[model samples]
Target: MSSVSYHISNLLEKMTSTDKDFRFMATNDLMLELQKDSIKLDEDSERKVVTMLLKLLEDKNGEVQNLAVKWQNNRHTRHYQWREKKPKYNKGG
Candidate 1:
């Protein structure tokens, strides 16, 4: 995940080459890595990843946008379910 942040930082720093395919590939890779349970992360890191993925979805290339949307949809479902879970309190609270 930190590696993805590194790539995203580099991509943001560049002036030229806003190639949609490149961005899309990077987003896809991040999403793939995020699916692994071994990759522990905090809420801030997760939010940053989601933000970058959304940007890739808005890329000019239609194919890239379509792929991003598919991935985004899957992400949305998981995220929504996680958010929807009710918080638990201690019995004495």
Candidate 2:
């Protein structure tokens, strides 16, 4: 895998950390990476990132949720497969 994917994979792992701080930092770092025009993800990585982002939208910590919201606007373009996954955690979805 490319270095960028490796880095993103590491960040994704951190995003799932039980510690809120780790999730926050990983989301922040991920936003920066996503903003890069050069960053790329294979199908599996893209799915994981989108899934994690959707899950994080409900993080108990408000700060992490806020960070996840920042990515919402660009996610469609960044991850084309995003349409395949919906936020099942949402009430009455």
Candidate 3:
């Protein structure tokens, strides 16, 4: 499995790719790889990816928009789960 950072960077670049097939392939690959165990990323990087994907969702091309939505939803789901499981801490008053 490729590094999450590398895949994210590649996906961000390829999301703007001129070739529709390539863009689709790259997006799908990124999504699949994200499901693997080794792709670690901090919250900020995840947010950046979500923002980028939200922009892609507005693309004029139907296929691109569809793929964007797919990634966005998957990321959203992951974030939701993460937030639910994250440890809650509070400082003394």
Candidate 4:
């Protein structure tokens, strides 16, 4: 894997760390990466990341759960926006 891809993978793994602070920092970093239009994940990595975020919903820490919920909502919003088809307008009207 490329260095950048490896770095991302490392961060994702840390998101599930037992240490709450580490997980929080990792989640924040991952969210920032997701918000970047230039960054793209392969289907498998995307699935894994989403799954990990979903699992974070059940984290013992309330702060972690809140962050997870926020990330999940943002991910869903982006997914829906991409999947939605825009209607074409006719100029003849």
Candidate 5:
């Protein structure tokens, strides 16, 4: 795997660490990575990241859960904006 992918994988694994601080740091790093336009993940990796974030919502730590919810909301809002700006094609019209 490329160095970037390897680093991302490591961060994702760290996100699930038993230590709350590690998880918090990992989440913050992942958020920063996601906000970068140059950082793109394959479909499967993207799905995995989203699934992991969603799972974080059920974390025993309140801070982790709150951060997960915030990230999810931000992701959804960004997606909505992208969809709004993307041109649509009419089929069979």
Candidate 6:
């Protein structure tokens, strides 16, 4: 695996730690990685990241859940890029 993959793997593992702090820190680190222009995730990594974010959304730790929410709503996430668009409401008279 490349360095990016290694880093992501480490963070992903941390995100699953029994300690909430580790998970929170991992989520934050992953978010920072997401913010970088050079971050590249292959198909498997993208799928795993997406799955983890969904799982984290229901994390016992509010902070971790918040980070996961922010990550899911960010434009950099390929799986959730559509979330960046404004929702449309239909009007029925």
Indicate which candidate wins on lDDT. 5
Candidate 5: stretches off by over 4 Å: 84-93
Question: How high is each candidate's TM-score?
Answer: 0.63, 0.78, 0.76, 0.83, 0.84, 0.79
Which of 3 and 4 is ahead in TM-score?
4
Pick the winner on TM-score between candidates 3 and 6. Answer: 6
Task: Compose the digit string of candidate 1's lDDT tens values, residues 1-93.
Answer: 477566545543331237755665655565676676566556676666667667766777787677668878888787776677758789997
Alpha-carbon deviation at 35 in model 6, angstroms:
1.2
**Which lDDT tens digits does candidate 4 get at residues 31-62?**
88888877768888888888889999999988
| Number of residue pairs clashing in candidate 1, backbone atoms closer than 3 angstroms, sequence gap of 3 or more or interchain | 0
Output the better candidate (1/5) by lDDT.
Answer: 5
Order of quality (TM-score): 5, 4, 6, 2, 3, 1
Can you write out model 6's per-residue Cα lDDT over 1-93, one digit (the tens) per residue? Answer: 999999999999998999999999999998899788678788899888889989999999999999988887784655455455548677872
Candidate closer to the true structure by lDDT (higher is better), 2 or 5:
5
lDDT of model number 4: 0.86
* Model 2: worst 10 consecutive residues (lDDT sum): 79-88
lDDT scores in order: 0.63, 0.87, 0.75, 0.86, 0.88, 0.86
Number of the candidate with higher TM-score, 2 or 3: 2
Model 6, residue 60: C-alpha shift (Å): 0.6
Model 3, runs deviating above 4 Å: none
lDDT of 5 at 1: 84
Higher-ranked by lDDT: 4 or 5? 5
lDDT of 5: 0.88
Residue 22 accuracy (lDDT) in model 4: 92
TM-score of 5: 0.84
